[model samples]
Target chain A: MSEAALLHNSLMLGAILFAVGMVGMVVRRNMIVMFLCAEMMLQGVSVSLVAWGRFHNDFGGQMLVIFILTVAACEAGLGLALFVVLFHRSGNLDITYWQELREENQAAFMDREVPEEDREKTIWPQLTPSGVEPAANPEEELHRSRV
Target chain B: MLTANEHLIGSAVVAALGLWLMLPPSGERLRALGLVVAASGLGWLMSRMPGLGTWAADAAFWSLAAATSAAAVATVVSRNPVYSALWFALSLLGTAGVFALQGAQFLAVATIVVYAGAIVVTFLFVLMLAQPDGTAYYDRVGWGRVTSLLACACPAVIVGVLAMMLSSSLAGFEAGTATVAELAANVRHEEHVARLGGTLFTDHLVAVELAGTLLLVALVGAVAITAQDRQKTDARKTHGGGASR
Candidate 1:
């Protein structure tokens, strides 16, 4: 097949992937999921770039993909750290919970108005029971506790 | 008339249906049906286009496209955050495959290593840490489904129109052609990694250095933010006697 046809096909695939990611970003509520969708969109753009580079017989597109990878890694690290802090404050991963950053006197449109009863409940992580319990025998306990 | 607008209409409808299926209102049965319809529509649209490249390459393209689109839709539609993350990884893998098919071996490997290996692990760690026990209410109940759908549809239509316009404009232009010997020589010269590295170190050196600085700054910022949070928690423990909880 001609290079033009191949480029067109790859571009089409990239466009579809990008649109899917866009929909995910708009519709998903979890902050991490939204971030992942953003990365997906980046991947789609990288694919198109590489395809275009091959069509033109240039390496510039591939070089740009490398830069995109670097930026994506940086984004993930910083975004995840911020997300962890946000979770600690609100005890949830919901994006709507982070309304404090909104402009002063701006009415929050995304905030969910949960009833007082539902708001009172805290969902703490439950530790699953695992590993061996400490042996009660004194001599055996001393041997087990050697670490 | 149908031939001209087939792909645009088909892709738009498929994407819109997929988005509809992902919305909170759709039940399991409807979502499943939507998935099937959307996949079929995408397949039909792909089939309408004339086959490009060798048979092997064409087969690979179609399968990778299917995998990429399916996984992308799954990432959006899955209710469980962990599952959504896993689907995202699968989608990334499919995208890497597409890059490989496009003769970007270096980029394919880099994408797999950076996105599938590192970034995905980071996302999973955050997902695990952020959610306490079970799925959160927001995961089950997406906000503003109709509004989001409308917003997304506008862009999809715009993209479809743009793609159609681009294809029509480029129809008369033929790609640069080379003899069989010249093609072989070009392939040998375009040693994917070497050319990429040459371009990066020569023409784009300043951009590369700036990217490195950006990464360093982001690292320090992340560390500072997390460390400050820890200090605040420790001070609160001392001053409030842990009663604030």
Candidate 2:
């Protein structure tokens, strides 16, 4: 293959890797696997960026890749935190089982007898199992239930 | 029958070798054999092409590429995180070869420092701290295989189409034709590091400082988050406990 063609082929490979990473991110249930998939995706972008930098005879893409690295680090940190919290609360990392963090909060609110208006404002610990404080007042009880 | 794209061709061969080694057969000796064979083949190919180079330099580059690819593939396929980290370091070294071949010495070294030195070390630390237990080969393979296959397909298709088009439009084709010697000479034109450093410090100083500050903050955050010893105790309450207790 010609040099240009070869380099272009590598870039295409990088793009395909990026796409697979994206799809994995969307489809994977395991948080750790999701992060790995994210890294894979980021690798694609990084390779393409560097390839472009070399191809264009410019250093801008390399510089941008530095920022990308920074962002990836930040993402890993945040994702790990979320993973830790998820594991602590749910004891499983399954994305499907993570519905408690999603729409199931409404069901929890209904079980607690929280009124519609107070449900949005009040924040409750999703994993606070069987901890109850005596109702001080009806209004406070409603709010606490939502919490 | 010496082609101008000898190094490029060698690089592709090495890339293929690296990808091929990532498949199965996790034996170190087997892996080493595959790597050696690939390197030897690269050397033989270069030797067959007249006017290419002396045996020593050709062998050096070929072995370098082979080693790099081998290490990278090993990292991806390894079950042990520590082993994976080591392999990652090797892979970075191989990627540096590409930069070097392209005549980007500063970029090559920067890749080594940033990726191998910083990124891989941090990953190692996280892996150690987490200590992800048990056999995870099935999980990694099932996902990795599907993703890798899907990823390889598009590029193959695109390259095939482009090649057909280029073949048809031969006169209009603008494939790069710089040889290894030409690229090396171009890269060594002057003190590239000095120019890069000057541009980075002066024109991009603030942004650089910002990155530094952000990294510092992250370091502090990681330390703070990981330093906590107790699972349930609040920081204030824990401190209130008497030493005698």
Query: After TM-score superposition, what is the CA distance of residue B137 in candidate 2 from its true location, in Å?
Result: 7.5
TM-score of each: 0.85, 0.54
Error of 1 at A131 (Å): 35
Q: Pick the candidate with the highest DockQ.
A: 1
For each candidate in the order shown, give its overall lDDT on alpha carbons. 0.76, 0.52
lDDT of 1 at B187: 33
- Tens digits of lDDT, candidate 1, A1-147: 566677777777788778878888878778888988898888888888887776666677788889999999999999999998888877788777675567889976664552122343446679999999977788777779565
Which clashing pairs does model 2 show?
A: A124-A147
Candidate 2 per-residue lDDT, tens place, B1-245, comes to 53434443443344334333443323456556656654554344333232214555445445554464345445444545556667656766765675565445676777777766766676666555454673233323333334444443443344334334433443332344444454334333467566556666777788888887887777677555544423433454577753321
lDDT of 2: 0.52
Residue A17 displacement (Å), model 2: 6.4
Best candidate, TM-score? 1
TM-score of 2: 0.54
Q: Which stretches of candidate 2 lie over 4 Å from their true place?
A: A1-37, A40-44, A73-147, B1-83, B132-134, B137-188, B220-245
Tens digit per residue, CA lDDT, model 2, A5-46: 334533543543454355445434455555655666666676
